[model samples]
Target: MSYLDPAIAVIDPVAAAGPYGREGTAIGFRVICVLTQEYRTPYVTQTFDPADFSEVYQHSCIDETVAFLKSRSVVAVVPGAPPSLKIVDVLAESLGLIGNPTESLEARRNKRVMKEYWTRHEVPCAAFHESGDLESVISWADGRGYPVVLKPNASVGGVHVFVCANRQEVVDAFNVIVSRADPYHQQFSTVLAEEYLDGDEYFMDLAHTGGGEAMPVAFAKYEKIQRNGNASIYKNMFSLPLDDPIALAALPYVRSVNDALGVRYGINDTEFKMTSRGPRVVEVNNRLPGASVPLMIQRCSGLNVFQENIRIFVDGRRTSGDYHFERHYNICCLINDQPGVVQGYAGLDEVRELLSYDGERMIAPQGVHWPVTRDLDGCWGLIRLVHEDREQLSRDAEAVHAMMRLLVA
Candidate 1:
C-alpha cells in the first residue's frame, strides 16, 4: 500500500451548524467546510459564497479547494443539477476528484432530463415533466392531475417540497415556489411536475468511483409520520439489503448517469418509488448519503460509513474491506415532531442502560426548541440498536422507543 496524505474538504451550505458537520471534521479527513451560512462547531469556520464571481464558486470554492489541498484533495461534495452544481463543477475541474460533469449535472438535476436519460438507458422510471414557465408547468400539472409531486430544480433537505393532489394545489405550490427562486435567471420559476408514485419508496446508495463502475452500499426505507398532509418527521428507518435484486434498481442507472454526468468520486443517493408496474426513478444526488441514514448505516454495520467516507476522500480508496467485520442489525428512531418546550423525556435512561453498542444518541436538549417543523430538527433523539438476531433487533428498536418520551413544555 502506498503511504499517502490526502487533504480533504467537505463543503456544505446547510450542514454548517449540523451534527454531521460537527462530527465529520473530527473523524479523519483534514476537512475544511466552506459555509454559505454559519454552523455551530468548535472547529475553525471558513466563510465563502456561491453567489460571488460569475462561477467563482466553481473555480475558487470547488476547483480551488483541490488546488489548496496541495495533495490528493478529495472534497466530500454535495451534487445537484446546474444551479446546484457550484460545488460539483469545482470537483469536475479538480485534480483527483470524483463527480459528475456540468453537462451530466444538467441532465440529472432537471427531472425531465433525468427521465430522458433513464429512458435512453432502458431504466424504468415514472414519466415526468420539466417545465420552467407557469403556463407549461400548470399545463403539465393539470395533465398529471391530483396527487402529483412538484419540486424546484435547486433545493435540498426536502425544502418546500409538496405532494399535491389537485390542479389548485399544484398551481398554488408553483406560485409559492416562484417567489423563492431568482427571477433574473434564464428560466424564471420553472419546476418539475411528475406523476405521483404509490407504494413503498426506497433510498439507494448508488455511486460509481475509480475504475469507472457503480457500487451499491446501503438502503433505507422511511415510515413518514405525517400530520394534516405534512411530513412532521421520519420515523422508524429500516436498513435494507443490497444483495436483493430489486434493491439494485438504481445500480443499472449508475453507469449511464456517471457516463452522462462524468461523476468521478463521492456518493450518489438515488430515490425510487416502487409501484404496481415496477420501480421508477425519482431523483439522484451527487454527494454522500445525507446525515442521519449514513450514521444509521454505521450503527448497524459497524462499518463507520462516516469514517470510511472520510478515508475515501483522503485516501482515494473505495471499498471498506480493509476493516471488515460481520454485519448486524441497526435502526434509527426519530423523536416525535410536535411543538413544545424542553420539559423531560421518558425511557431514555432505560435504553441507555440496555445499550450493547455505541452509535446511539439523544441530540435534543431538555429545554431547547422542540421540532415544530420536519426540516428544522433532524432527530429529537436517536435509538441506534444493533443486534445479531433480526427478531431481537426488531424488538430492541421497539423497546428503546418505548423507553423514550419527551415532556414538551
Candidate 2:
C-alpha cells in the first residue's frame, strides 16, 4: 500500500511520554509530533514532550501547524484526540490533505452547535438548548418534559453529564458542571440542556472515505447504569447483529448526520438513542472510538480501525462491504465508586476461573491513588468475553460483575 508520505504527522497523541506517540513510528511510518496544550502532567514532569519525536514540530496554534507542515513538506496529518480533530482538519484543509470539511469542525466538537445544526437540517436529534443560566436551562427542559440531560457543551466521556428529573436536580447539576474545568482548562459555563431520549442506546462506527461513501465498520448497544439521575457507570455493551432491526434503521440516520455535517472523510463515532418514534442522535464524535473499542473490533472482526483510518487519510481508500464478525462479543466496564488509596484487589482469581478468560484492563496498578467515579474516565477497567451464543454472553457478564471487585483503602 502506498502512503502519502514516508512520514505522517501525528498531533498530541495523549501523553508524549507514552507509547502512543511512537505507535506510527514503530510501524515504519515516520510520525512527526505536533504539540498541543492538553498533554498529560506526567509527560511534563518527565520532560518527555512530543517535541522529542524523531522529526517533530511544536506549535499551539492551528495556523502555525499548517505553516510547519508546509515548511517540513508533510503529506498526511493524523489527529490523535478529540481536541486535535479540528486542528488536523484545518491542517488538512490548508495543506490539501484528504479530510472532512474544515467548517464541520465546530459542529464536530461542540454538542450545542451540533444539535443546532441537526435541528436546522431536520436530522433526528433530541430537543436541546445551550445556556449559562440555570433557570433558562430548566425552563427549556421543563417545557420538553422530565429527565433532561445537562452536559458540558464540549467534553469527553460523559464528564459532568447529568440527567435531571426536576427543577432542583437541574439546578444542582448545572452548578456542579460549571464548577469544574474541562480538558482545555476552560470552565463549562455554558452547558447543553437536552431532552433525555428514553430508549435503547447504541453506537455506530463508520469510516467516511473522501470518495463520498461512508462505510460501516461496527455497532454496539450500550447499557448504562444511572445513579441519582446521573450516568456514573457504563455497564454491558453487546455487539448487535448486522441484520438486527435497530442496526438497520440506525445506519441511514448515521449516514445522513455525517453527510449533513459535510463529513467527506474521517472516522465517525455516532451515538443514537432509539425512541418510541425511532432512532435519534444523542452525540456525534468525528474521531476514533474511545476505550478498548479499536482492540475489541480487531479481535472480533479482524478489521483494524486504526489501519483503515490511516488508509483513508493517506491512500484515500475505503472498504466496501457489510460489517460482520465470526463470533459474538460482549464487553463490560467498571467504575471506581469508592474514593481512597488503592491497596489491592479481590475476586479476580475467582472471576478469571469463572469466565475462563482474562479481559483487557485499564486500571491504575495497586498502591496508586484511586478517585471516586464522577465521569467516564473514572472507569477502572474492562472485561470482554467472546461467545457464540448471545444468551450465554449475558449470563457470563452477570457472573463477572458479581465475582470481580476492585479493593480500595
Candidate 3:
C-alpha cells in the first residue's frame, strides 16, 4: 500500500477518542475527516483533535462539501458514526463511489423506517409503533401490553431508550425523549415504541462487499443491567467464536436484514436479540461498531474491521473468509452511580493487576465532574480482558466488576 495514494474521507470519526484516527495513523493513510457543528460538544471537543487527521473539512453546505471532495484525490466516502450515515451516502453517490443506496437511507437510519422496511421485506423483527404525540404512543403501548421500549426514531448508543412497564412509565419516557435533542443535536419529532424482546442480545459486525454479499467479522453477546430506570445500559460484552451455535443460528437472519436495508457496500454493525421465536433484529447501524468493539474483535479474531473497511471500499478487495476466534476477549463497562466531582479511582490498581486485565480507558479522569451512568455517554470507562481460557476470563471479569470503583466527592 502506498501512503501517497488518494485519501479516504471519513465522516464524524469521533468515537472512542479516535479509533479511526489511530487506524489511519497506523495504516499510513491520508485521511480526511468531515465534521459538523453537532460534534462540537464538550465530550467530543475534549477528546478529539482535528490535528490528528490529515485534513479536516467542516460540513457546512452539501454542495460546497461535494465540490471540495471532488477537487481532491478522494477514493471513498464512509461514515464514522450514525450521524454521518446520510451525508456519506449522499457524498458517495455524488462521487459515484460504492456505498449503500441513497433512496434507502431512511431505512438504514430511522428505527421505525428500518422496521417497516424489514417488515416489507419479510425480515423478522420486533413489532413497533411510531408517533409524535404522547397519547398515540401510549395507546399503542397499552395495546401491546407491558414491557414496551420507547426511544427516539433516530438515535444511537441507547440514547433516550427506556423500557416502560406501565402507562406512567411510558408517559415519563415519552416526556424525557421529546424534552431533549439527541447527541447530534437533532430534535426527536417522533418516538418509536417497540415490543421488548426478552432474550440474549447479540451484535454482529459485517463487511458488505457488493451485490448483497457480506461477511461476518465478529459476533458478541451483551450483558446489560437495569440501572437508573434504564433497561439497556451495557455492563459487559464478550466475543464469540464463529463455530459457536448462537453465531451460526443468527448469521442467516443478520444477512437478510443487511439485504433488506440495501447495504451494498461498507461496514454494518447490527444488533439482534435471540428470542424464543428465533433471531430478531434489534437495530442495524450502517457503520462500524461503537466504542472499542473493533479493537476487541481484532484481539480475538485477528481481523480489524477498520482496516478491512478501507481495503474493501478503497482497494476493491473481497471480504476475507478467514475470520475465527484466536482467543477469548471481554470488555467490561465501568458504571458510576454517584454524581459529583471526581475524587479518584478506588480499586483501579487492583483491576490492572488481574491476570486477564489487558488494558483500559479512563473516560472520566481525576478532578473532572462526573454524572451517574445513564447512557453510553455517561460510562466511566472500559476495561478489556483477554485469555485463552474462557472460565478464567469470566472470573477475572467478575473480579474487576467487584473491585473497580469510581469515587466521587
Candidate 4:
C-alpha cells in the first residue's frame, strides 16, 4: 500500500504531540503533524464529569485524532497514542498503519507481569515482594539486607519510589503508601521492596527491531547527586567503555524480556545498576529517553533515534542488529537541591558559546518549574558536547557543568 505522496496519518491532538514528535522518526515517508480538537485538548475534556464511568473515564478522542490526521493529508497513518492503545489499535486496524494487533501490547506496560515473565525466563532483577499489609515490607527488605528500594508500580519519572535504609524508614514508606488517595494507581506501587544494589547507574535506550527483538542503541552512565531524600542534581556522560560490560551482562535479560512481553514498537529507557556481581536490571520504560537522548545521539554518533525509529516504522523492517556508535557528551544539570518554581536559568549565553566550541544541542527554558528527585530525575534540560574524542567528552562535561546553574524561586 504505497501512497502517491509520502505522508503519515498522525494523531494531532496537543496532548499527544510530544509523542508524535518522537514517533515521527517512524515517518521516514513524510509526516503531517496533526492536532485533534478532541484528542488535542483531552486534558480539558477529561475534567468534565461524564455520566458513563468512574470519576475518571477514559475519553476516546480518536475521532478527533482521525479528523486531525486527515486534515494533515498524511500519506497514511502513524499514531502515538500509547495511553489509548485501544484507539490506536482500532485506527491502525481500520487504516492498516499498525503492524501487529493490539493484543501484542497488553503486557508491555505492566511491571508485575513483566517480572513474572522475567522470573520464568530466569532473567535477573532486583528482588521484590507483593503484599497488602505494610508491615511485611520491612521484613521483605531486611531479609535482603540494607539500602532497599521501594517503587510505586506503573509509574515513570521516579514518582513515589523511595530508598529506605532501616526498618523505621520502611515503616514510614509503608505509611505513605497506605495514605495514598489513589491506591489503585499504586498497584505497582504495591511496595516493591528490593535489595538496593549501589553502583554505577547506567541508562540504556532500546528500540524494537521490527521483527520482535529488543535492540540496544545508546547508553549512558549517570552520576546522581542526592539532596533531601531524593536525587536533586546530577550529571550524565555517554557510555562507551561502560557500555561494553553492561551490554554483555544485560543483553540476554533485555532480549528475553522483549520475547516474553511481545513488544514490537516504540522506544524504551531501561535503568540498570552495576553490581559487584555484574549489571543488574532495575526498571524498563516504554517511552523514549525524556531528556536530550534523541539530540545527543545525533551529536555524538551521527545517529538519530528518531530517524531510525521513523525508518523502522515506515519500512516495517529490522533495525536492531549491531552497529558502531561514536561517543558524544551530554550532562543534565538538574535543579535537584531546591524545591520551588524555577524563576530563571543561567549559563545559556556561556553554554551557547561552549556549544559553539563543541557542537552539541542546548535544550532548556527559563521561568518554568523544575523539581528535584533523589535519583536520576527532573532535568531542567541539558548541554550537549560532541567530539570524536571520548576524553574531550569527559573534560567538556566537567567544565560545562561547573559553569551552569539553575535558579529556582
Q: Which ten residues in a row have the lowest lDDT in candidate 2?
A: 40-49
User: Which candidate leads the pack in TM-score?
Assistant: 3
Error of 3 at 354 (Å): 0.9
After superposition, the stretches of candidate 1 with alpha carbons farther than 4 Å from their true spots are 1-6, 13-29, 39-85, 91-99, 108-113, 119-122, 130-136, 175-188, 248-250, 253-260, 310-316, 319-325, 333-337, 353-359, 371-379, 399-403
Instruction: Write down the RMSD of all candidates, one decimal each.
Output: 6.4, 3.5, 1.9, 6.9
Clashes of each: 15, 0, 0, 22
lDDT of 1 by residue, 290-365 (tens): 5356655666556555445545544446654322224444555555656787687777667776644345555566
Which is the leading candidate under lDDT? 3
Better of 2 and 4 by lDDT: 2
When summed lDDT is taken over every stretch of 10 residues in candidate 4, the lowest stretch is: 47-56
List the global CA lDDT of all models. 0.54, 0.72, 0.82, 0.55
RMSD of 3: 1.9
Question: Which tens-of-lDDT digit does each residue in 111-132 have in candidate 3?
Answer: 8999999999999899999998
Q: How many backbone clashes does candidate 4 have?
A: 22
Model 3: residues >4 Å from true position, as ranges? 1-4, 40-47
Per-residue lDDT of candidate 2, residues 206-296 (tens digit) = 8877665577788889888888766646787888776678878788888888777777776668988888988898888887776667667
lDDT of 4 by residue, 182-229 (tens): 211323336656667767887777777556556677777776665434
* Model 4 misplacement above 4 A: 1-106, 174-189, 212-214, 231-234, 241-245, 318-322, 355-377
* Lowest summed lDDT window (length 10), candidate 3: 38-47
